[model samples]
Target chain A: MTDLTRLTIAEAREKLRAREISSSELTGAFLDAIETANPHLNAYVKVTPEKAREMAKASDERLAKGEGGELEGIPLGIKDLFATEGVHTQACSHILDRFEPRYESTVTANLWADGAVMLGKLNMDEFAMGSSNETSYYGQVVNPWKKEGSNQALVPGGSSGGSAAAVAARLCMGATATDTGGSIRQPAAFTGTVGIKPTYGRCSRWGTVAFASSLDQAGPIAHTVRDSAILLKSMASVDPKDTTSVDRPVPNYEDAIGRSVKGLKIGIPSEYRVEGMPAAIDELWQRGIEWLKDAGAEIVELSLPHTKYALPAYYIVAPAEASSNLARYDGVRYGLRESGKDIIDMYENTRAAGFGDEVKRRVLIGTYVLSAGYYDAYYLKAQKVRTLIKRDFDIAWADGVDAILTPTTPDAAFAPGEITDPVTMYLNDVFTVTVNMAGLPGISVPAGLSESGLPLGLQLIGKPFEEETLFQLGQVIEDAAGRFQPQEWWAS
Target chain B: MSVDIDTVKRVARLARIKVSDQEAERMTGELNGILQFVEQLGEVDISGVEPMTSVVEQTMKKRQDKVTDGNKAGDIVANAPVSEDNFFVVPKVVE
Candidate 1:
């Protein structure tokens, strides 16, 4: 009984199997924690306490029969972006007000097949658009970690902010999150947890709300590297429903934990040392290099020459695709609708009223880039730039680089309203976006604390479908840095 | 490369989003700021590079073109704002 909420998913699984604890007890503990913490953190948009209890009871039955799934009885948070059957699946956008899918997403279906219980839908940036969680219609998810001795609230870095903050605050053992750019990794870094954006096609995008379709991917955010590895094994699979989902068999990722990094080549790109990055981040990056080197990883100084262009080009490509993907919300089939004099007018009114400011800006930017006059200058050019960006990684991998190491974000978590400009906010993904751009796997492992006492994370970028390698390397970093947890100020 | 207010309005119309004169003006500045940021892409040399069609390297998977899923009309319109007879109701398009 030492705070059942504090047990990692791995520990809880063992305890549940041994009958030392029941899934009902574990689920109840998480529900109580969420009820206490959610008011202050705003991490959960919807809590399925009844459903969770029912699921836990079912899991207890399965466990008693010794026939439970991999994640049997383990409670987790689901980002609002994923469609949960008959549950709130808003993607934190008012556009989908009170909308619930009749069917489940393949990823969530996969988790349930492995017996994971859904605690609730976690809050996120509207349409998964912002770097900070402020863009969410439910309001920002406050970071569980605070600056040393400071009472000022900090943002849990976003789109997946609720997932990270919930895990860090022990609201849930792990949470499902999607990454388009750095949604999963950056928030995990900010909240002192482990999150991985498995390669683009690793998890089916069937039920997840579309952001930038090509860049969007689903992954897990958990308390420890091992927990993340365990969750991912159940989450990733080849699905025929999504054409982009690769046909390869999903590997047992847990086996990669504690795997030696001997003879591995860790690439440290010169370009990621961006101008105006705080000295502490650079120092942390250096420490990561030394840690990997100590673990027998050969460090190599290399260059991703087109690194500078990746973000600018991403702004164009992502928004362009987002504009197209989001065009489905025309007040016709589902969600919010604003009546107008005519069909065209209705479409206009609905979208204008439905989408948040950040979403609108991106949609407009997307429209402008794909417009007839500017298509060649913007969209096509950005695509070509994307080619070069991917080529940079392709070359590195061809040269025998096992993985690339960098800081997860330019800095640690900041106050909610500190950043207002869109372009400035987009820079938060600088170190992490290239992985999504190249369709490669990446993991962010909490590494150390910033000078301000907020948590910082080091990221590992791996070859396509090489998430096992990232897990192996991420465990090395986690082993060196140790786990970080925020002081429980909210419950009191 | 900056978008003028008129162009912003046009783009808003094209995107089927209503923006007032004031919102469009504000968006003009914001869009210009982002356009200026992305203008840096012009510096990259793309001599003979082809625009990437897909990020992953794979041939498109083909499935047998047969009737597999249907008969869930009620489920399809489960969240529709207005629906009847298993069909989504929208504002009349044809005059």
Candidate 2:
């Protein structure tokens, strides 16, 4: 038979329902794929084979009874950011070394309720801080996609890099990822995968590791738009655990797939046309507009004047929130601890040893901005700028614009160490952070290949709680661009 | 809005993260670069704009003032680096 690991979630779901394959078989195939690919890709930080087998067996029994959940028998990789009960829940940071949670995140709990099997915890940037996976204490996750005939390994964009890489490499049908500022969408662009960061509260933040509380959101990464849609339907819900989670009914997002975009207004923000963007990214974005236009979407040229300031403002807001949220890691409750002569000294020493450089830098930035003399000049100013950024989107929505389209990243995935300057590295989120700032839903669909044979993606930004619209528009781009997958160079 | 070595050390202390003198010197330049980049926010006129407290407009949800979850002290400290009788063990501070 064909590789069961290669089947999309929708296809695998049908096959399992028809008894064409068993959940055990499908789960085993993914486990085998992960076992083979993980050493090369470093995508999975921990593989839960026994737990997967146990879950698969339960799913098989449920399937036999004609009573299965929406994601029945589907296997997925969990980003390490989510707290899985009795499982490693590190956010790819040494600070969380050997930490296991007794509680499950509301999002992952929802997935399990739908009968999705957990393959393992995927790697991510430490505390989901960096754009590249280099900040991951577990090491960088290699992008499965390679430049044409080049042996050099590329970074799967982060901090959802492992989620994107695993889906592209077929280690899991889909994976859970979170975006504080473009973590989900940017990495999805780097790999040939579909990722959606639903509106800020679409998924509960109950047990996911907090990066930037106000900006962080959980979403899914998958090989196909339909798979992402399916995963999201099960992932999103209003939870009492997370007050920010909207009290809205979870729509069947899968139905939005293949929905027509006839007469829809697609906004093309002129501000996204940043200076010095590569010609290929611009061309791909143009192609996305054309694709929508051909599908009956009226393109409107618009401007979000605050777009240029979004990144700078985000650096302040996110790190400020991050420093506050991360203060809980005081070396007393859980994870790694370094002893000192006193409690305060111990806290300092533990955090110093536990956190990586990027985390430390951001924490210090946060502390400085929130300090006695700088709060108004820095933190409050960034918040005011954030208001202007959100106003830009609110205006666009009020003008009857259904969704906005843009290139997901400024360029295709780069090789690790290609860019070192922290400010330079932050530009990766240029196209994505605005969605988070505005509390909007955004989806990245692989649209084309770079001149170097790397995958490029186009993003769709929708209004709050309008993830279905993004899924619909994302399918249009997916159908137009077709799928881009890497050759199995690592499958030795 | 540039950060000096002294400011970097002060911020690191406030953040409760130890930084060596050498690391603080390097961090000074890095933090200054970021602070300079964000200084552009000063240019945007915000005389009337309110600082956004939340992205989505929602009143804080109130729940009944009753116990919902409890009696899991063991689980709470299950992963603690050092624990005794379900209580976390930390360095003594009240000596």
Candidate 3:
């Protein structure tokens, strides 16, 4: 059996209901994991032990009275980007060093109501900008899985690195993570855990700190697909607080788990097999395809010809929106403020002091793209490419492809500081960003480990709101995916 | 593929971040390198293309135009480097 620390939410819940352990005991074991793992991994910026215990105590009361919700006293780490009433959500930047939120986000509020306790805020790249978590002011998150024969520090992907690290280290059963462009999935891929970014309009963004407001959607990072399903159901709601939130009814996510993939159509976009990808990863992708074929699914060769342009289009569109959304943080507004000589200077000084280097870099890039001389040249050109990229996926789905398969990142996690050139760093997200740009649902399931034993994930991208297909096919691949879950931290 | 240092200084000032001359000199080179790399987007011609202003299809996420302050007065002011009551404090306007 897996250690209590690394048990999935389903496993833990079953154990709790059968009186194998109390809620407090379950919470304690995970909390112990957090204490042991956090120092080494730097996954959490804050660990709320007392608050976790209090929630666990409440769960015990609910159980004793024969009342139970989906996630009773399950502990998960929250990315600091989510606003929790009274929790200091710094976004891992010095600008909000003393910032505290007054109200919880719709997602965080829903998790609290579902009886999920937070293990406190996890670290992230400042304002969720970088592909790697190294840009976080707090520090970089080391990948929990080490190279089999080497003792080097590796990166757990980001800007959701903390969530992935904590999950891989068995610090939390699951974590709340957001993906603007592969923030959740890439990190999960790096750390050998499962992370899902649901359909774009599925989750409310009212209280979550905005990145690219349009692309940011929060979901769960867990050990199994079912745990992700249950957490997804509990968190999905038509939140009227966020105007961008859709009024769609939540689906019975877990009800569909264990459903068979008798005749599903999976797409392998011809373009995704990039020129320089590793042979091991190429073989792993092929293996996942073979598993689906054995399960009676049809493998179709689809073309998203414009897939090559996804990264460039995304960089333009995301930063363009982010430039505008982030304007709210100017000194006089809600975020941190810096005093200056006059009103104008105040805006200048405050923002100057508040934002970190990467945030500023993005702001500048965004501003330049939106600038008069360049607007028509850069921003407009990128948008046109976006339309073509969407058409590529639209054509594939039209060609009877139920879902598309690709590697989450080109390869497994890299060692720290290996890729310093920002453009090279940006290229790491090549396969994952396309899904976000097209506003589709995509998931990273652990395919297998690399030759040196680092994790590799097979990304399955489905049509928008077609997450059900992804989950069904995932079950088949997961059965054959031996040793996909994290090896025990102690065993190392 | 070189960016003028003066242009970097101007962009930095526009961004409202205070960068030293030495930093600006270094950043000018870095920014030039980044721009040169990002300039690859210009390789594809996109005549008559409209800009994608928002990723989410929504034009704006609006709430009711109610006549009430955001209401979390204390919490809003807590992060202020300087605050008084429910408002952020700044230098007095002499005008």
Off by over 4 Å in 1: none
Model 3 quality (TM-score): 0.94
The CA lDDT at A372 in model 3 is 65
What's the lDDT for residue A142 in model 2? Answer: 94
Model 3 stretches astray by more than 4 angstroms: A331-339, A485-492, B1-3, B43-71
In order of appearance, the predictions have TM-scores of 0.99, 0.99, 0.94
Q: Which candidate is the best by lDDT?
A: 1
Better of 1 and 2 by DockQ: 2
Clash total of candidate 3: 0
lDDT value, candidate 2, whole model: 0.93
Q: Per-residue lDDT of A69-162 in model 3, one digit per residue for the tens?
A: 8788788889989998888787787667667777788998998888887778998988888877998988998777888867788889899999
Which candidate wins on DockQ? 2
Model 1, docking class: high
lDDT per prediction?
0.95, 0.93, 0.80
After superposition, which runs of candidate 2 have C-alpha atoms over 4 Å from their true positions?
A: none
Error of 1 at A386 (Å): 0.7
Instruction: Compute DockQ for each candidate against the true complex.
Output: 0.87, 0.88, 0.46
